[model samples]
Target: MPPLNYFVVESPDPVGKDAYERIAADVLQDLDLIKVIDRLHIYVDPKIPLFVAAGLLRHMPRAIRVSDFANVNPGEKEIVLDISEEAYLAPLLRILWARFGKENVDQPDRFTVVLPAGVIGQKEIEQLVVADPSETLYKDVIYALQYIAPEGFKVRRQYIREGKFYYVASEDTLPGDIVERVVAPLFEKMGVTL
Candidate 1:
């Protein structure tokens, strides 16, 4: 696994800290988040019934479009999408099917899609979004953190923006000053002003 810029786990209990560190690392790896997360700090205090995670994310990939993986060609009576990459073929087909209807869209082969000419333009098809990495990113990050956090720490608070994220979970209601007192300090240690 590639190394994160910084990874820290803080807890008063040495044994628990070590155990949590391993658990956190395993979870991050399993969710394929290590590459995206640049810096991470986790604080767990079972006694205080708190689990806090703060991190910075690297630049996420832009949305994948038809033109990214396919070449649009105009045929006599139909528009031909000469797919260069098969990975996004399924999504591309689904979007085409939805927009043009199943009957109007034809996938004669794994590498091609045909649509009736005049129904949609080549420029429009090229811009159709096949995938957006950021759409599922926050969900994946939150899911990974939930698994790393102590089980039953149900009361939760989370914030993710631009390239920073923080998750707080506890059985008890979170304190009002938690961000200023806990999360902010963690980010500070990571050399992030927030």
Candidate 2:
């Protein structure tokens, strides 16, 4: 396997939940070559917020492509979708509903949906609204970072470019050296040497 190239350091500020989701999506899109190993962990201390992410560098999973997650099946009057393992559930459902009409689609669970017959092709679903194509993925990543941070902490961030992921926590000012020292022993104890 390639050497691990992504990191998730804690942020200095707190961010809302929605913002964090967007940031995670954006980062996955921007790095375009990284696979998120796990969901981001946001911890809110009384004064500051922290973030931790771990993953391998790779392309993000495609949202519109049927193969990306859902399997489309043509039924007599509706299209049945088996989306058991797909991650982008919300956006996919939104797009499907918008294209097929709210009344035409039925979502009984997180992993299954029924689309009316009139809208069974890929083109219709692919046209669903998404984040502006012109917008940089980094902006989304930052938004996600903010969302993932605690509501009280105030900070922003960018992609994890180098081996060391960067972060700015809060006005309180925690030094980078101190963070490294603190994390080092913990990683060492866990038998993780980077």
Candidate 3:
């Protein structure tokens, strides 16, 4: 599928659409989230200090497993992880330590961890989850929206699911019909039912 199409669907100030587009482009590119999104509809009403960002992601990112990053060797009483890539090394070590404890988990080198002496089953190590990119992407999207939205609009609400997200921000307490006012019209225009 193609990358997400981002647009300023509605804004209080039509002239400001260009600026918002620029900001969105920069922020999305900076976070490496441009391609993951399939469509983006943003609405900003500075006069009311309201901003909404709604988008559908292309697909859910896959979970990172222990096998994805390291080679697992199951021995008689322990499993040794030969961490090939260092990118997930820290988190991998942290998870191992958390699961097996500081004493049970050992790191003799920068890229090695041993689950000394058969405390857990072998399959557990193979199926360990190192990280979930979808979770991280959700947080990144939330943080990016904070930057994209006007600063100081602290009241925020977000709805994120498998591969879709909706966010809203405002300075004051938000009204109930805000979604109708902000996202519904954009969705309708995009031919999206919800």
Candidate 4:
């Protein structure tokens, strides 16, 4: 199992606690999020029909840009891009075409791209963001939480803010003070503030 600085699943029933531990572990692993989660605490109170998950995330990598995998250089008549990794070729091309019309951008080969002179500056091209891992990571975390929650526990609240993430769900309308009552205490157990 990948290391999570802290992990716990609490329930009034010991059997239910063990089952939730297994389910949460399997779901986090399946979504490839075990390493990204620094600490986690899940509290399931079936008697009250409530579930809460509080967690802190590790520092995530920054966005992917053209310069990360390609080289931009000046050409006699145009700007040339020498791509080193093919994985980003498709997305790189899409961004270029949208920013500078397709007429101004041309790809002559699998790993080469040409842009008309004065169309865009080399520095600007290098900094154009192609993908942001944090954006996708937030979405993935929400999906994983939803999967871990008990079935029919549909009413939900989720947050990804300031290096922290939280999820709360219930079959009935949640109490107005869930954050102050249940969520805050759970995060306190992990040495984090919600």
Candidate 5:
């Protein structure tokens, strides 16, 4: 297991119990994992900044290890992929394009692509790029993840300062305990008894 990292998210409106469940599902869908530790925590302050979310994200799972999001099939002389989602498709395509020539790559749809054989496992295919040098592919994926939540949610400020993270959504402030109470029951409803 890798070291845990914290995340802070803010919304422009009061996030109710239903909203919390949606957010949790989105997180799970984005980062599919077998089991996340019980240490996970979420804080929702619906006072000034409308809504705020802060918590410790334990053992962040790898994108490729998640599910069939990126299917790699060995073709006669190439690797065919049937990407059903665009959330992480850009980065995957960019990395593949860099390895195989532009001519060797083919995009049949917004969510599908084909790559030459030499690039299948010959090079390092990064499942996740924390920071992208090109800026386009990386930033797009990050933006997409942020938008996965409901519409009312507006990201005010996200900071990973020091070892702790703080995210302020709107312009209001609420006690951290309140946020915890709001999310607790939702977790239980999601079958996370803890």
Candidate 6:
């Protein structure tokens, strides 16, 4: 088996740790974000009606271009692409349609796309950005955290730094010092369990 990632859930009940870990891992994997997270710390106090999740994310994903996942060739009247990876396919299609107009971009198969000549040059196609994963990742993380956090603790505050992210939620209004009081302590303890 592969080494386990740094994941912790601090609650009065340690019995639920395994369940939380499984859920967290599944979600992160589906989002293609499991490896980017260096550590995750979760704390919930039912009595206090609070939930906190603080994690350290590695450098975000860089902008992905069509050339990074597909082979492109400019023909006399069209540009053809043979894609080997489908991870960014959806975004690539959207970008192509937007730049070349829907009528000019054609997908004859799952692994191929054709573009009319003059729609975009070979060099331009090579550098055309399909997606910026980090931008959507931020929103994905926030959405995932909402599910991880306890239900009914709807009021929330979130913080995102260069390589870090923290979330706090509670039933009642949180004070300004919430991060200093809660997330800061958990972040301090990350990368090593106490």
Backbone clash count, each prediction separately = 0, 23, 1, 0, 7, 0
TM per candidate = 0.93, 0.38, 0.84, 0.92, 0.37, 0.81
| Candidate 6 wrong stretches, greater than 4 Å | 1-5, 13-32, 191-194
lDDT of 1 by residue, 88-109 (tens): 8887777777787899998898
How well does candidate 2 match the true structure in TM-score terms?
0.38
Misplaced by over 4 Å in model 5 are 1-68, 122-163, 166-194
Better model by TM-score: candidate 1 vs candidate 4: 1
Q: Write the per-residue lDDT of candidate 6 for residues 172-191, one digit (tens) a residue.
A: 99988888888788977874
- The local lDDT score (0 to 100) that residue 109 gets in candidate 4 is 93
lDDT of 4: 0.90
What is the alpha-carbon lDDT of model 3 when measured against the actual structure? 0.81
- Quote the positional error of residue 85 for candidate 3 in Å: 2.5
The alpha-carbon lDDT assigned to residue 112 of candidate 5 equals 67
**Model 4: per-residue Cα lDDT over 154-174, one tens digit each:** 999899987899999999999
Better of 1 and 2 by lDDT: 1
Which run of 10 residues does model 1 get worst, by summed lDDT?
91-100
Candidate 4 wrongly placed segments (more than 4 Å): none
Name the TM-score of candidate 5. Answer: 0.37
| Per-residue lDDT of candidate 3, residues 1-194 (tens digit) | 22566454567787787788788888988888887877888888888888888887878878888888888888777778899888888888788778778998888998988887577666777688888888888898888888888888899888777676789999999898877777677667666756
Better of 3 and 5 by lDDT: 3
The ten-residue window of minimal lDDT in model 3 covers 1-10
* 69-175 per-residue lDDT for model 2 (tens digits): 56667767877778855656676767666665788779887788877776657554444443332234334445545554455555433344322232335445455
Error of 6 at 167 (Å): 0.8
Question: Whole-model lDDT for model 5 versus the true structure?
Answer: 0.46
